[model samples]
Target: MSQKGGKFTKEYEGKKTGRFTRNNEDRKNTRFTRSNEDRRSERFTKNNEDRKSERFTKNNEDRKSERFIKGHEGNEVNETRPVREDIVEGRNAVIETLKSDRTIEQIFVAKGNMEGSINKILGMAKDKGIVIKEVDRKKLDFLSETGAHQGVVAMITPFKYSSVEDILGLASEREEAPFIIILDELEDPHNLGSIIRTAELCGVHGVIIPKRRNVGVTSTVYKSSAGAVEHMKIAKVTNINIIIDKLKEQGVWVYGADIDGEEYCYNTNFGGPCALVIGSEGKGMSKLTKEKCDKLVKIPMVGKINSLNASVAGGIMMYEVLKSRIDKKMQ
Candidate 1:
C-alpha cells in the first residue's frame, strides 16, 4: 500500500509541472502580439505627421510664388504712368529756348556731358539767370517725352497764346503787309511745328488756328519746332471762318491751297496783304472754309500720289508769297 501511494504522488507532481509550463508559454504569446500592435500604431502616427508636414511645405511655397508675381506686376505699372507734357528735351530745343523771350523755369543737363554745344548753353543760362542743374542720365530719361533729350531738358513756363489783334498789330508795327498762315484743323503736331518754323523764316506776321480740332502747342510741338515756336505768334480763335470774313473786310486776301485750284500757286497774286490756308493731313480744307477764300491755288505735282504733306505744301506756298513780296520790293 505505501509503494502504490508513492507512485501516484509522483505522477500528480509531474502533471502540475506541465500545467505551469503551458501557462507561461500562453502569456509569452499574448505579450508578443501586444508589442506588434503597438509598433504598428507608432508607424501609422509617424506617417501621418510626415504627410501633414509635406502638405504644409507645398502650401507655403505656393503662397510665396503668388506674392512674387503680384510684386513684379506692380513695378511695371509704376514705370509707365504719368507722362509729362510740359518738358522740352533735346540740345537744339534748349538752345533755342535760351535765345527766345520765353521764361524758363529750370534746365536739367545730364552729368558728364559738358562739351561742345553744352558749354554754350551753360553760358547763356548764366546770362539769363536761369537755374541749371546737373542730374543723372536716368533722371533726364524719365523726364524726357520725345526720347531724344540729347542730355539736356528744359522746364519752361506754359506757352501763352496771342489774339487776332496782336497778330495784325505785329504786321502794322513792322510797316509791312499782313502775311498770315491759317491752319484748317491741322492735326499733326510735327506738321504744325514745321509750319511754324517756316512761317517764322518767311516773315509771316502770325499763324491762325481754331481753338478746337487743332492740336495745342505741346512738348512734341516744341521739340519739332526746334524752338521756332518762341518767335512765331500763334493765335487760337473760336471760328476761323469769322476771322476770314473780318480779314476780307480789312482787305486781306485769303487764298486756299487745294489740288483742284483754279490757278497754280506761283502764278497767283500773293503780293497784297495775304493769308494762306493749309488743310489737315488726310483731308484738305473744309468746304465752307474753302468757299470763304478769295482764290484757290494748287501746287504742281506729277507724282503717283495725289496729295502732299500739309507742312510740305504749306512751306511751298509760303515761299511763293515771300518771293512775290521780294519781287515787288525789287521792282
Candidate 2:
C-alpha cells in the first residue's frame, strides 16, 4: 500500500503541501511503513532460517523472562489473578484444592512436617500443573485466611469450575443413561454440601447449580458433604431455565420435585437421559423455573409437615433416581 497523505489545495490534485503539518504527514507515512504486515512476514520467514529464529526470540525475550515453567516449555505465563479468600485455612482443603483447576500463584507447604500428607501434597501439585515454594510455618500462617493454614498454604487464582456442556459431554460418552442433578437456588451451605455428596454417591453424572442466588462450595458445605466435592463436577450457570430447556432439547427429561405434581419421583422411569431439579429453601422452585420443567414430581411427605428439609429432600430424590437406574441395570 502506498503512503496515505493529507489533502492540499495546491496542484497535482492530491499533492499535500503544508508547513507544520508536513511533520505530521511525515509521521503518518512512517507509521504506515512500519505497520505493513509484509514486513512482519519477512521478519518471521527469512531466507535464513536460523537468523529468523534468533530474531524472533530476541524480540520476544521480555515476555519470555517472566514465565514460570509448569512443565510446558513456552506456555504463556499463567495469567493469575488475586488469591481467593477460601483456601487460607484447612490443610486438607488446601491439598484438595491444589488437585483441582484453580491456578496457583505460589504454594507454601510448611517448613517441616514434610512426610505423609505434605509429600503427597507436593506430588499432587507437580502433577496438577502448579509451581510450589516451600516456606516456614509462619509464612503459611501469615497467608492463612482462617489462621489454620495447617503447615500448608497456597495462594491461588479464583477457582474455575467446569461448564455444563463439558460435564454433559463427559456423561454422554458412557453407555448408560446420564443422570444429572440441577439445584435451583439452594441457599443453605449444608444443603449444597449434602447434594454433592449424594450426587457422587449415586453416580449421577454431574451437578449444575445457578451462579446467582444459589449456594456455593464453602468449608462448612464441604465438611457437611464429607469430602464428596472432590469427586463431583459442579457447574455454575446464569440461567437455570435456559439450561433446563437445553437439556430437554438434548432428550434429557427435566423433572422438578414439587408437592402438587402429577407424579411421584420413584414411579417415573429415571433410567434415561434425565436431570432432577431440586428447588430453593423458602419459596421452592421459582415459577419460571418450574414452567421450564418437563414434568414435576413429588416426594410424598408422610409426616405432619408439608415439606422436607432441602438437603434431605434432595438426598431422597437422588437415591430414588439411583435406585431406578440400578433396577434397570439388573433387568
Candidate 3:
C-alpha cells in the first residue's frame, strides 16, 4: 500500500498503528519508522484489533453519510403538494360528516356552544379520528360557506363522482361481473354518502343516481360517507330507468329494494352482472323505476319497523350481493 514517492501515502500510514499525520508543508520531506517491512509485518498481527475497530467506525460513518446523500437527493428536489379543502358548515352538517368515511382536515367549533349539537359534533369528530379546533364565533362565521355555522364547521376534501361508463369499464377491465348500485331518486345526502361508502368497501364497481328528485352529492353526503365517497365512482343520470335499461342490455340484472318484494335479500342470487336500485328516503322507488327492475328484492324484518334507514338497507343488500359473488368465486 506504499506510494512511489518520498513520503508514504495516507493509506499506508493508516495501516500503521500510531503514526502521526504530517502537515502538508512537511509531507514532502516526512520520514518513516526504521526497517519499514519488518515493522509493518510485526504490527499487522497486533493491529488486527485496531483494524476491526477502525473498519467498524469507518463503515458506520459511511453508512450514516449514505443515508442523507445516496438515493435521496432526487426526492429532496420534488415539492410537497397541498391538500384541497371542502368546507361543511352547521352543527348537523359537521356531525353527519364526521360520521361518514370522509377524511376531515379539521373541525372548527365556536366557543361556548358545546352543549347539545356542537357537543355531539365534537364527539363524532373525535370518534372518527378527525382533527378538532376550537375557535371564536367570528372564525366559524368566516369559514362558513352557508352563513349558518350553527356553532360548528368542518374542512374536508371535495367529493369526486364518476361516470356510469367508467364504472362498467372498470368491471370489464377487471374481467369480473359488474356490481353496481343505482339510487332511484334518493333525497338524503347522508343516505347517498353512506351508500357510496358502503359500496366502495363492499367492492362494487360504481353507483348511479338520477340527476333530479335526488339529493345530489353535497358536503353532508361527503361527511356521511365517512369519506368513502372519494374512492367510489358515483354517476348522475337524467333518468335512472334509462340507465337500468342500458345496464340490462349489457347483461346486468336489476334488483330493486322494496318493502314488499318477491325475493328476500339474503335468499336471492346476486352473483353476476348486477345493479341494486335503492329508493328515496321518504318514497321507495318510483312506480316507473320499480317497473324497470328485473326483480324486486326486500329486506326481511321481523322487528316493528317496516323499513330501515336508506343507507342501512342499501348496505345490507350490497353485502348480501358481495357475499354471494365471493362464495361463487370460492366455488
Question: Best candidate per TM-score, number?
Answer: 1
lDDT leader: 1
Clashing pairs in 2: none
lDDT tens digits, residues 1-331, model 3? 2345425655566645234434532453443433565678778866986899899999988886575343233323111212123777666556655666767888888777779777777777777777888888767644443345677777877755678899999998989899999988787666887898889889999989887787766655655665466567788888888889999999999999999899799999999889999888888889998899999999989998788989999999999999999999999
lDDT of 1 by residue, 27-112 (tens): 77777777887788888888988888888888878876565444333434223544344677787878988998888999999999
lDDT for model 1 comes to 0.87
Name the better of 1 and 3 by TM-score: 1
RMSD of 1: 11.0
Error of 2 at 146 (Å): 7.3
lDDT of residue 127 for candidate 2: 80
lDDT of 2 by residue, 1-331 (tens): 1233322234334333454477787888888777776687676666567786777887677455533322123213212322233543355665656665556676777666788777887888788756777787656544443344567766655445678887787787876677889988898776887888888888978899898988676554545565577678888899988898888888999998898888988798888788989988888999998889888999887888899888888888889888888888899
**Location of the lowest summed lDDT over 10 successive residues in candidate 3:** 75-84
For each candidate in turn, give its C-alpha RMSD to the true structure in angstroms.
11.0, 19.5, 21.9
